[model samples]
Target: MVHKKESINRKHFLKDVFICSLGAYGGPEAHYSVFIDQLVVKKKYLKEEELVELIALCSILPGPTSTQTIVSIGYKMGGPLLAFLTMLIWALPVLIIMTLLSFLYQFLNQNNISSTGLRFIGPMAVGFIIVAAFRIGRKVVTDKITILLLLFSAFITYFIREPWIFPIVLIIGGIVSIVTSNEKNLWTPVKLNPQWRYLVAFVIIAIGSIALTFIWDNRIIHLFESFYRYGYLVFGGGQVVVPVMHTELVQLNHYMTNAEFLTGYGLVQGLPGPMFSFSAYAGGMAARGSGTFVQVLGAAAGGIGIFLPGLLLIYFIFPIWNKLRNIKGIKISLKGINAVAGGLISVSAIILMQKSGFSLENILVTIATAGLLLTRKVPAPLLVLFVLILGFSF
Candidate 1:
């Protein structure tokens, strides 16, 4: 009896360790959508309908739903530090991978062998982007006006190509929506917290970040600036971050090659977690030749840059999200922004099509993928997995 009891205790200890480590290591590998769904089902003690409703609400917002869901779960489980730790774990893997990739690319460029097998990734990536645009467009665009906006945005973007156009269009749509108001449920409040501590904490964190930037090296400063702007200023979701980062890191700072950026972006789409991991890849590559300390610092900075803003927004807004839920103006604005986001994705697809030099085979694949996404009940991650396999095989 004693031996059996000791064995049971040992098994329980190991099981706890495994779960904790899994949570940590699985951060980058964790699918934000899946994580949220499972947590609600297993841990939150929520019913199916409630889980669905929660997911729907999260999905409509600007940030990655998966990350937001996890943060929410952590907050519910253990408060702010747990939320922070969960996000930190989720971001760590990409940080490490991206830093290494950056070093490898730099070394390869120096050796002139960079083109050996990497050249193919570019066109393949364009194909993936084209597919993504179609997938997102089919769902978000329901009416002719939305379709026209999408096509017009694509055409304008293909030629003129300014980074700020995306957010500008979203804001314009929001303003127009507010003016055209019709919904009656716009101003109803759904309260979360009434205390001001969350807001105060956020301001303090921002101040600390600013102070840190001054004390750190230039690379660290650049990382903070890039992430801080990405988190705070970015209005739309993951896709918006791309253009913003391109403008800042690629066009302005010249931190990464266009090929490296796009490749990392494509890989991110295929990955299980949030798309923000692309920042890790970019930061890692950018940090190369700066030595080990700089590399680690750069990677950490990049990870923070990608996720901190959305996390902060969630914390500060949670108490007020329900209150603002029924605000007619906000709903209209969100609708308008969603329309613009659809347009942006559609435009991106068109660009990908041109760049990929689309053939019948590629066209068929894209059509099939989009059709599966729209008409069928296939999940996004499963579809992504299928495409990744298909992409490598073809």
Candidate 2:
């Protein structure tokens, strides 16, 4: 259902994006649930199958998977312009908030702002993941083979817990499905007019930024290079990027203290939106010695740098992906790919529950959150706000 330019409700779409940003907590795992609720169920912007396919596609990509998935939705709904707006709407507010929060480290420390108020959030996010896994699982698990694949993917991911394991599992699942399936005549090729210019732009910026950093010895350029590298090189989302950032920002360059880096990370976990927004906080801290203006510049550079590669890559690849779907082979493969993706989400619930703990209160919060979401009587944004308020009250 492609919309004409004039027919697309740009305002409505952007508003939904903002609402998602405000309520998007946890990392990509939990963010998928929010996308399913707001974008898939409520808005009917896309089907669960299409969204799952996007999830599978983005999971194979290197950057923030949830961010890429949402951006792809915008591209599908409108065009590149709407996709750009989606990225901004989904990430900018938290970026700005994180940038400002970089200046509040001292105040937070002096005032003893414990993250206690945010404790329930982790379990709440687990709730979201549980519901998403259930919903996605119901849609994707169509046969005995798919059920086994789902369980296998979840079990393997739960134990291994490595970044590279994801794409490998997804690919293996795809191959397995194709080999075992009854579908014949699945490999017809279609002419693909991929926009290689976006790929060129991505590569040029990557190399250019690195070379410029070497030649300039400027702090801001260095920050951009570091983050742009992070955006492309890392497989998993913020969890994987955190250690890399810690090594570079704290240990290697001494850009910031370990304590400061951890503080920024903790704060980011409490806030809504992409976890990549932590880049702004780190970049701001990295430029703290320079000046206020430089710090803000550093934040903007970091925000843009970390998200740029993914945006470019998605823009370049999405069109090709859309075309490729016309191949019967690709359609057949989506079943296993989506099944494995569902498994990935399923394992995340277990991992997060372990991290969040198995206390009665935490379990109750998770149960309550999942229950309310399943009931569909409450809006996600309101549910999120209520949970935050409840957490703070405790």
Candidate 3:
């Protein structure tokens, strides 16, 4: 008994978790999502529902839910440092593999682009996001306020199509939440209020990062900026990032073609690890015109760049999440924010389809793929593989 206790005590929660992450595969659903849940449960690290709660919270937060979920678990097992380390471990495999794929593509005729099946991923990704939005939104859009915010956000976003609009939409939701929510249930002035400080610090860092982009427009900085913006701002999964990153990397920078973007986007679906690993592939494509070394560096920057903001957020926010969650006003705000996130995801599907040319076939695929996912019968990885086969047949 003592030996078992000692062994448990000696467990390096961070290292153990990190090692586990290296083995996670099949996007968010297959290995990453299931394995981590099992690990945390077997280790007695957290109650099953507790992890579920964390995941629910992460779904509303932004970026990759799996990444933030691991960070939160790591933080619970260790602390801030462990949380950061978990982010690195989670991303390392993806960075390496994506960079390698980038290097390999140099030998291939990217111009001809034979991955015809992979290109279908773009439309399917659109459908995937729509399905996800419905699933998430159905849970959060409880009343008129949330429904109004959801529709309002989606309407403005569909028309304006501005990346900056999301944060403003969220701010409006927060304000509406405070104004409309039951005042009696709000948390009273406690010993300390750190929420404002964290928000201010986050804003300053974001501004500083943007300023640095202007001052030093280097290869690395540019890669980071593109991904950092997407990683920080995007609320849903890869479905949402597809459109946002497309604008920043393709439309704005002209780093790669639409076909190239879709290929990588689809490819990541089949790959093991996080959904954001596609950024590393994008990083590679961005610098495919350059040397091998530069391509690898770009891949690293893209992977780290996109992953960092959310890593920082979960680390900073998770500790206080418990305190803030209980406040009625904050919960109301989160409800609104969740609705907005769903709205953003909804618009993203539309944006991706438009960017993909809005073909009848693409529309049909979107509907079919969305239907497959909504059934919840098929695993996402298998669905991706099936799509790959179908991509070839079609």
Candidate 4:
């Protein structure tokens, strides 16, 4: 269904982007593996070592790994404009679907018809998170230090219930590595790649957003800042972004209730593009308080804000990726960051599990869902729909 070795034209890129988006619609692993095949196996776009470098970069940055990887490769192959267009193209489908799902989820919220569905979906999302933790953990946590870091990260995240805990955990891990003389290959700091315009713009936008948040207390500003912050901080893809958003939008701001967060989280599981599109769903839910006009604006702001920074960062960084990879400091810090990411993800799973209100019956549902995922018997979308219907029917 995917191939390379021939010169790729613009038409082919678009076609491949569309096809990859469809393939990813099934689940995170599916989308990523499909993309990996497209990039590494079929296209030979990037050598294995180069691809690993990109993977580490994605792991350190925020938002979805697959989406970021796609953008990074596109930027490398082309440039800033191409990368932006590529991300827009690859994410357009999911952005639309998630927006529609947001409308539906909002309708369900208003009518009270889908609580049961959300009930099933929410815990099942925890199951998904559990699967994600296992999948990523097995890859990253190979030593006692990482194991201890995972536990420590989880303990702090679960107890602190604050967003700063993320950076704090990363810092702690980095310091520990430095102190322990764990001169392993982690994030070796490097001179940020040039593209002075993009770099300056990124810095300005970041600072401006932060400054705006402090000066103004409007709904739109708050919403955009929330999305931007989540986009910047979340290291791992999809599932990991959940807890960060949970704390900011749900717990702190009351933008969405637990029900709303879990519902959006569970629902986005079936969307075809970036998992970050949940920001649209969340924005829609929050905008329910205002009229339709504000709702649409919120939706656009949420989705765009969630996506823009990471795209900028990836595009700007790609030109110098070769040089950046050689920095020993960045390499070691990345190891710390990755370890913290694993632990943070684990904590998010626990939080979701708790919020799902696991009773004996819920237990059965969770175990069954996890088992099904483990077996790989059904596609992700179908499995989600099955649970969704089961929720509505029961």
Candidate 4 regions with alpha-carbon error over 4 angstroms: 1-8, 25-29, 39-50, 109-114, 184-193
Better of 1 and 3 by lDDT: 3
- Positional deviation of 124 in candidate 1, in angstroms? 2.2
The superposed Cα distance between candidate 3 and the true structure at residue 78, in angstroms, equals: 2.4
Better of 1 and 4 by TM-score: 4
lDDT of 4 at 267: 75
Model 3: lowest-lDDT 10 consecutive positions: 1-10
Error in Å for residue 250 of model 1: 2.3
lDDT of 4 by residue, 126-219 (tens): 7787887877788778678878887898888998988787777878886765556556655556666477776677778778988998999767
- State how far residue 351 of model 4 sits from its true place (Å): 1.8
Q: Give a tens-digit lDDT track for model 1, residues 1-394.
A: 1112123333332332234333431122234334434444433333445445444445445555556655654544455665666666555555566556556555766788534344344444455455456555676576665565566656655565665565667666566555555556655655456557666765676677777767875777778656765665454446656655765676567887766776566555544445666677777766767786787677677777767767876676654655655555665666556666666666665655554456676566556655664464665446555655665455
- Deviation in angstroms for 232 in model 4? 1.5
Number of clashes recorded per candidate = 13, 0, 0, 16
Name the best candidate (by lDDT).
2
Tens-digit per-residue lDDT, 254-314, candidate 2: 8876546655665676688998899999999998867789999999888999999999988
Candidate number with the higher TM-score (1 or 3): 3
Model 2: residues with Cα > 4 Å off, grouped in runs: 1-6, 106-190, 324-394
- Pairing residues by index, what is the TM-score of model 3? 0.82
Query: Least lDDT summed over 10 consecutive residues: which range in candidate 2?
Result: 235-244
